[model samples]
Target: MTGPLDIHTARRRYITVCVLFWLPLGLSIAPLILLFTERGMALAAIAGFFAAHSLTASALELPTGGLSDVLGRRAVLAAAGLLNLVALTLVGLGSAPWLLGLGMALMGAGRALSSGPAEAWYVDTVQEHSGLDAELRTGLARGSSATSAALATGTLLGGALPWLLGLGPDLGALVSEATSELVLPLSVPILLGAAVEIAFVAYVLTALRERPRPAATLRDVLRGIPATIVGGLRLGGRDALVRRVFLSAGATGSALAAVELLTPGRAAALTGASESGAVLFAALACAGFVCAGIGSHLAPLTARLANSGERAVMVSLGASASGLLLLGATAAFAGVASLVLATIGYGLIYLGLGAAGPSENDLLHRRVSRSGRATALSVQSLAQQLVGALTGLIIGVLPSGPAPWLLGGSMLLAGTFLWIRRSGPASPTEAATPQPHTASSSPSAVGSGPLQQHADQ
Candidate 1:
């Protein structure tokens, strides 16, 4: 507290926080849909469960950000971890539809609670430690890369653990009298996830600290949160650039939902067996995550090469859409060739998303003040969740394969056009230049002038 925060320290903590929070999520993903089916839930019901999770997360997103801002990021994040611990436990044990849905709702709440607080803490700490004009791109990019690596690693582990368990002792037979036959294998990854959530809580409690806010009090915090939420809501309505970014977030979310919802099944069809499909999907998922990490690491270079963040986003989104189109086009093919194309397409989709994320967030940070930063991020998340939910419902009704991918790809392609109509704030490189600060009475006053000087650059 006495010394200024070093950039390296800030960056390390940011990446660590991201890994801790997202790793459990990644672990659960590989087994989640299959687990539900193993428990005998119908397709429609499974879709409902996913929709419930998304709606819960979307509804709570803005309010939880307010909670983070008012109650302090550490406390809110700790609570989120605790909730996730409980949720993962319930999910691991519960076999009934209602119970599973309840677990999902709790998981959504935890997700909403955890979404933006850690990143907000990182930025606030960095700005406090190293002045407002300090370099942020490299640190942010590293954090994104760390998250993708965690997902890639976790997905592979989660997928392999169950099969590995089956290969070992008959743990399921021991519990067969107490639970369903498939319970033991399906529960392993989620139980491991619950354990990780415990670690996440402990880390948040011990590692993160809030900067002193001399003027902040219980009454002021309660009053300010609502005002902050309103300001966040106004961001999209009032700012053309922010609105365009929000639209893109929605479109990208849909594309992601398509891949996540459809790809495992597609992978299974390629192998013609559930067990083998699961294994193949796991390998593909891991590879996809690696590609994501590579893309995230390349974001800054991509932006510089394109001469602007907006241009970088378009390039990335175009690549993503093209990948999805490749997926759709190759749907009719069978055997190793189809599998190869699908894998490449899936990897490219994640690559684009991973590359676009840091650039998008960097621009967003320049547009909003610290007071509303978390809330703005929450809004961005809300857009994704809302669209993701819609995408799930649409995909559920649509004929399997190709059709959903085509729709998702079309939406992503449309998202790219949003940038053409509006110019956003200056690119990250331009914002990294030194600038003077001005004192203002407004709580939302932040050093963003240099951040917005794209016209001159």
Candidate 2:
């Protein structure tokens, strides 16, 4: 963590960080809403809880990304882990609504803090040894695969733990009694997530080694962060390729929003009962993550087959859009064929998104130098989150049919078309050390962020 590492060492550490950082979040996913319901929160309150988390993360994304650029990746990541630790503990143990809400906000803050630093650290490490010529797709792909694997594994474990405990002499009751009704069975996964967060912090501190930035005063950070943010905002305008990446992220967010919004009720309808539907949805969710992991693992081959990173993004996203269209086309049907097609479409959606991610990021990395890497990533994240939220709002009001699915697919398809031609940089890395534009050429765009560690982002 303190010295220069070889590329192999760096890749290994990057993969480890991905797994450790994501596993705890995965653990909480299956049971978080369930835990809230167990604690007497109504659907409205639970929705409010999530909104608080989303808003907090969104608001903090750009600033936190700047913080990482100004501070160091390791420091910001460690701080994120610490915040998650406290957040998880509060969420698991607190009975009061306000305490739970505060916990969620803190978790959002932690998410914002952690977003881009880990990957930025990996890119920096590789670039240190190999300079601008490093083959980053492999590392990024593997890290992404590890993340999906951790999520799939954690989802299974989180969902099963409570049931397993219940089957063995009422262990859950005993724990609740011991804690005076505070530690419910549903709380177990979140508490375990808190424990895992400890490991995440330790690993981040010990494994994600980065060359330190120069020590600076508070004044420097205040000045540096805003200036860095401004420069990052200009990144998209100055670099057309990076703009494509940002817009593509928004398209992805839109498509994902549609699927997430529609999938649950579809599952329930298929199963004919909410309980069975919940079980089926969980299974499908786990399967989707596995498919995404497989796609990530195959990203290198995907790039090779498509002949270029840009082409690979086009192919991958096109496939994803096609899947959305399939869903939309079959929305009015109900039969074995419909079910089979729907399942295939679901798998394709995740797989294509997963495959496209590494290639897209490889392009982004090549365009930006170290000075504003994390901030660039934050800008991408913000676009995705903001656009996805907007898409979700629109989807919410639409009548149940293929319209929503078509709308999402069309948006993604439009984004895919943006890659039909090169984005007009004579050289891809022309902006590797980019600067903000002068007054004569002023141009704008990014907001304040997660397709991050979760599919839900």
Candidate 3:
């Protein structure tokens, strides 16, 4: 009998979905960075924009996530893509700061709309077709890889397009020879990205599919917000293991966001490479993402080798924190080589995190009811956003120069230590156990014991 999830079909679907989803994100990066630069905006202004963007998206995440649970994932995803198309268009055209901010806010709304639903759709669809256990790792890994690939392609295009279009340094030289007017080259990529987003929306509306409706009614949806928040918290609170996972994930996410925000400046300063330096930093970050994708692909193997999900999570977090610390410290005192090395470390950490993420998600999913799963996941999403916002805010308040490195390193170290403390120690014997059995098993299996034991090991 054919399983609901045909691996080949699911892989194609996952890749297609990721491309549709991440292309906008990838296209947005360079253009947005350039947008701020072209507009003569300060880092503070950009940070403010990001903070507001994240806040608005965070506000909308729960409701939108619940909507996906009720209304149908495809509908939500399509809406998200359309929203992105509109947002990117506005961003491309707008010259004024207010207009740009408005566009950014709209983009954030689009992001919120898309975030939880798309992942849920992928997971649910694959599980329905192939079975959860069979499809989870491959599907998630492929999705992550597809997103990274889109990001890499977009970053490269974003950097290369202006130069190719006769709007870059060569254009400046040409203009000096003629009109003596420097054409702002950054806007070109923004316009191009807007075009790409428009195409993505069309693709999503045409290609994306949804599972059967899992929830109905506005009340049901509204009720899900509190239920999800409380239920996820309750579940995490009760389980030491789950709580550790959430905390570690949240902390790592915060540190990463901070690192991302600061690294470009550090790269530019250290390399003396100008605006193009930031683009290089972005490319390096994407490299880390590629590593992460590879790690996610190898997650099953890493988990097997490590012997426990908790240990894998802990190791990944530690590695990521170490990378952040190294990046910050080296960038503070050293040159471009250190920056590159830091990036390499960042890549390794991402790979580890990618490998661990599925295991952590699987652990959480096991603890929550189907009805509440989306909501619980939304809470997790919220934690990530909240942490990101906090990190940005902190970085904004801190002094410049190596301050970012110090702050990032401190947060990472603190977060890592806390995660380690929360995770505790795993015995060597505990890890070598076969699949479908956890360390915390009971001799007398009863009711949910067998399933729980299977999951835990």
Candidates in order, TM-scores: namely 0.86, 0.94, 0.79
**Which parts of model 3 have CA positions greater than 4 angstroms off?**
1-5, 37-48, 130-132, 167-185, 202-207, 214-220, 223-226, 335-343, 397-407, 413-457
Report lDDT (CA) for all predictions.
0.75, 0.83, 0.60
lDDT of 3: 0.60
Which model, 2 or 3, shows the larger lDDT? 2
Among the numbered candidates, top TM-score falls to 2
Descending-TM-score candidate ranking: 2, 1, 3
Q: Which residue pairs clash in candidate 2?
A: none
How many pairs of residues collide in each model? 0, 0, 8
Q: Per-residue lDDT for 380-412 in model 3, tens only?
A: 666666776687878888787667766755665
Comparing 1 and 2 by TM-score, which wins?
Answer: 2
Give the per-residue lDDT of model 1 (tens digit) for 1-457. Answer: 5654677887887899889888888889888888888778899989888777877888898888776765667888999999899888888888788988988999989989987888788877887787666566667778888988888878888887877766657665565545645356767888888999888889888778667543556665666566656666766876676777788888887888788788878878877898888788778778877887888899899989988877887888888888988898888777778768877888788888878777777666666556556777787888876786699789999986579889888988898777665474455433332222222212331223221100000
Ranking of candidates on lDDT, top first = 2, 1, 3
Lowest-lDDT window of 10 residues in candidate 1?
Answer: 448-457
Q: Which should have the higher TM-score, number 1 or number 3? A: 1
Clashing pairs in 1: none
Candidate 1 lDDT (Cα, 0 to 1): 0.75
lDDT tens digits by residue: candidate 2, 113-146? 9889989899989988887778999999999899
lDDT of 3 at 245: 54
